[model samples]
Target: MGRKVEEVVEVLVEPIANRNGLELVDIEYSKEGQDWILRVFIDKKEGVSLDDCQSVSRELSDILDKKDPIDKTYLLEVSSPGIDRPLKKDEDFIRFSGRKVDISTYAPINGEKKLNGELLGIDEGNIKLVVDGEELNIPREKVSQARLAVEF
Candidate 1:
């Protein structure tokens, strides 16, 4: 059910995002208190604004009402992914080159699963990360999840 909801949301939101010049970073439908909460994360080169969120919310809400993909009542939230945006695709790795990132792998590579360092970017066939004075080329297939690490 959850998976279906995600798929449907993507199908519905992609056009809206494209029309508004925003990237649909992620979507979540989860329980909070007694209600199900739906959140859609958006981003752009200049960052998203409250007006963007409100516009998306209004338009998407109307579509959701008409389509009724989700039968249950839920509160909808449309917002930005913020500074710690997820690195979901290979393109993200290329786009965030030279940025600091934290990544986890499906299994240990060189005896570790978690790696935090500067991302040099995606090369022809690998993800290059500089860790501990050494650069490790982690193949994209091995990465489980990655996100920009907020450096304080």
Candidate 2:
């Protein structure tokens, strides 16, 4: 049910983002506390603004109200992905190469489930990361989640 809502929202929101010169980063639908929340992550090369979020929320709200896709009431949220934005696509890996990243795998690789390092970008079908003093190559298929990591 959640997955279906996400799919629908993604389809509904992508065009709206594009029309507004925003990149659709991701969409998430999940039960929070006792309510369902639908979050839409948006971005741009110049970064996003409060006005951008407000515009998207207002425009999308009208569309969702008309379409009435979800059976239950859900809160719609639109915002920027921020500095720790998730790396969800091949392009994201390329775009964020050389940045620090945290990667989590569905299964342990090299006896590790999580790795934090400098992203060396994707090669072939694997992701290369410079961890510690060594380089680690993890298959993209093995990655469960990945996001930009702040170095502090």
- What do the candidate models score in CA lDDT, each in turn? 0.91, 0.93
Off by over 4 Å in 2: none
Model 1 C-alpha lDDT per residue in residues 35-66, reported as the tens digit of each score: 89899999999989999999999999999999
Judging by TM-score against the true structure, name the best candidate.
Answer: 2
Model 1 ranges off by over 4 Å = none
Against the true structure, candidate 1 has what lDDT?
0.91
- Name the lDDT value of residue 63 in candidate 2: 91
lDDT (10s digit) by residue, model 2, range 1-152:
98899899889889989999999999999999999999999999999999999999999999999999999988998999988999998899999999999999999987899999999899898998998979998999999999999767
lDDT of 2: 0.93
Clashing residue pairs found in predicted model 2: none
* Each candidate's clash count: 0, 0
